[model samples]
Target: MVKFNVTRKETSPIDGQKPGTSGLRKKVKVFKQPNYLQNFVQSTFNALTPEKVKGATLVVSGDGRYYSKDAIQIIIKMAAANGVRRVWVGQHGLLSTPAVSAVIRERVGADGSKATGAFILTASHNPGGPHEDFGIKYNMENGGPAPEGITDKIFENTKTIKEYLVAEDLPDVDISTIGVTSFGGAEGQFDVDVFDSASDYVKLMKSIFDFESIKKLLSSPKFTFCYDALHGVAGAYAKRIFVEELGAPESSLLNCVPKEDFGGGHPDPNLTYAKELVARMGLGKTPSQDEPPEFGAAADGDADRNMVLGKRFFVTPSDSVAIIAANAVESIPYFSSGLKGVARFDIVLLRSMPTSAALDVVAKHLNLKFFEVPTGWKFFGNLMDAGLCSVCGEESFGTGSDHIREKDGIWAVLAWLSILAYKNKENLNGDQLVTVEDIVRKHWETYGRHYYTRYDYENVDAGAAKELMAHLVKLQSSIPDVNKLVKEIHSDVSNVASADEFEYKDPVDGSISKHQGIRYLFEDGSRLVS
Candidate 1:
């Protein structure tokens, strides 16, 4: 139709725009404004120097959500204008969060001969559609999401972006093809390559995990396992790895197909959204319930989140991390060579503050360093880079090591399989085996469960949420008066550890995040209000 070239102009909104925990996420309508996405994309391009853009190869992919394909076209044009030469896009614009990280690290590299990084368009587990939220995030050459320093620079550039350049209206290239196509006025220049999305990522997984061992485990007739992809991108990966590669029965996988709208359901792999899986595990053979049948594991949208269950048993993410850490050498090949040889006790195992103290026990037992950081996977990246830790996790269904930079749901599931296989090799019976639930139960029996329950007052007015947090903080400060009532319920309630609003300073850049959440810890091992 029509072709045009555009350039950035100094603009108010383009100056100093910040990205939150994931990216600049707001309501879907916020991104629908004319030239809204263009402005941000231009600002991002302007943030980088020509040296950073010229001849650089960038990996581009998204969660296969609505608006993702359109955004990819815009990015391709913008990249060409910014001097980017080659771009590697996932087939069908589908890439899990961890897969994006893997591609950036494995494909992108120095010398500019390979893809150097990527721009991931996803709001993560957040709902996605024309009417839902959309987002864009940049990953650095290391395959990790841009640290605060880089993101801040991008934001700074956004605030003062004068203009953004782009080809007027380049013909849309067929993303289904695994080849390069050029945009902009010049032919055979400004190329974007549609790469096999699952190829590079699957290779990375095979390298990190012991697929043979897991396959052996899956082959055993006595052992039974299930996997649910939650209608996210992992369906393909799961089917390939679990069914095709490992020969696990296809029936073992549920919802093992990706859907643009996640089959009209929330794709979060938490107790709330994955109720079907939980219910199946809880009620064996009860056809009365309309719940989907039980599965051993469930993955969330984008396949970065996971929930593990075993018939009537649930595993908290805290216990999962601790268990994996405690058994890493035996279960995961990456660590089997003896972590002591590669890293020192500086190996800090970290977890979110709200997570149970189970990892603390593991760290103490193993004599490894441990840290309790604010909730958010980003907090662990610094410790991992410092060699101060090898692994970290959060109470939310997130777990990962220094392997890539994000929580890998499938990786965690494979870890469980490896652990189970090792136990089976030791002649442990299914009943005698230490499932995630058993580990958590034992942890609680020793440390006592926190009786934790998170109240997420969703959609509450921002002002009201703040007021509620303030009230909680004030109540924590006046705990002495409330101690009498608290003691009546639990007489052994000991000294209340200092209570205050939780704040975090990024260990890498020292950017402070205030009021991450509120926390109350008691000497008796009970915690409240996070």
Candidate 2:
């Protein structure tokens, strides 16, 4: 018989558990310390308040990376001891970041229950294994990351947390199968439900996109497509949506199996890390011989980040969101009501010194309202929650819309596919299909192109990185001198109109965030900065 008595284990507070922009990510060994994961989880529960967590349905899942299975069992036991009514988990503890958000928003239980919050286990694009990175972040009922207030409260709770409650003796529930595991607990009956990870997200994608149109494009011999999941949980959804639902050939999918260590390769979907994808797209150092696929894409470890390619060309993340926004009303069925919904979904945008001004150009041309915010995707979520922006993205391969609270990797891929299909609908079987490069080139010719590039000297001397950041700050006082030097260097370069540190005040929450980054604005809508 399973012992379900709650255990009140006294424990000392642990230090350095604060969450960053994404979540509380640390080395796996750092997370393996006694009472580390428990204290943080309990602190998050406390931050949500005892009433909210008690008798509430919570979702727990991740990318099936190392230690995620064990973490899920531990969290399940803790939830039972804390009087949680029911916990929903993906099969085998596998769920992408966006899928977790989809479950919170749409998944319904056997008795019409909906998830109130979630503990998303992932280190995002970071490498994962027993010796690699792992992380956990809490999401609210709104299907968004816990707002800054909640995260701050959780951090504060962690500092003074005296004890954690857990049903330590509860037998580990089997998560490999889709079924409900029941246990009699002191508070009441507790349940753990393991469900298919891809169903809810696949439903959401189907609702938003026209799968028939995409299938037509995929079946066309002229329009070859490839998708690399980087061995993350995305493979579950990609196989379900891309191959099963959309009728793409299984051979077109690569690395579509989840691995504990991401097949010993960095799972980030960038030109630097997604080597197999780059090679298949004919962009690697040793390029492929066969003609590259007409379209190719890759997703990060958790599948909330994406990199899109056209043969050897790459589509910048910022442009991907803007292109999606521009074509959504026509290509995607969900936006068919002309984006003038209960709340008008207009514009694609981001803030100061954008990596690419292409989205700003689209917003300006469409007469959509634009905004500048601090350097964090959460701020974009805030803006979207207020109905201020419809689509947003970062230069670092993240893109999404107000459709879901989080950046979605698969959604971006679908958007690109929709654009491709729409552009060549009449010519699906023709010898020539409009390609990704053509779509991007056409967008540039019409909207005006802005050269975009980013340089990151990462994993460098920590002290030197700090010194470099400080130097950039110090240069603010000499803006005029910098402009003069720029003028001396090249007449084609624009003069610096202003230089300052970026700060933001959230109109929705009245919260202040400062020093997002330094920007050097030019006289002709150009920017050069750190």
| Candidate 2 residue-wise lDDT, 171-233, digit = tens | 999999999989888778899999998899999998889999999999887888899999998
Candidate 1 lDDT over 1-530, as tens digits, reads 23335454334563224787676776567766666777787766666666668878888887776778888988888787677877788888888888888887776433346666788888777776667767788876767777666677778866766667776566676897877675554423577788777877778878878788778777765666778777888886888788887889998888877777777777888777776666666633444353332228988777878887765777778778887888787677888664766464656788888887778888888778777777666677766666666777877788888888778898888888887777666544344444555555765676445444555566779898778777778887677865766788888778676677888776756778777778777777667855
State the C-alpha lDDT per candidate.
0.74, 0.86
The C-alpha local distance difference test score for the whole of candidate 2 amounts to: 0.86
Top lDDT hit? 2
RMSD to native for every prediction? 3.6, 2.0
**In model 2, which residue pairs have backbone atoms overlapping below 3 Å?**
none
| Ten residues in sequence with the least summed lDDT for candidate 2 | 342-351
TM-score versus the correct structure, for each prediction:
0.89, 0.95
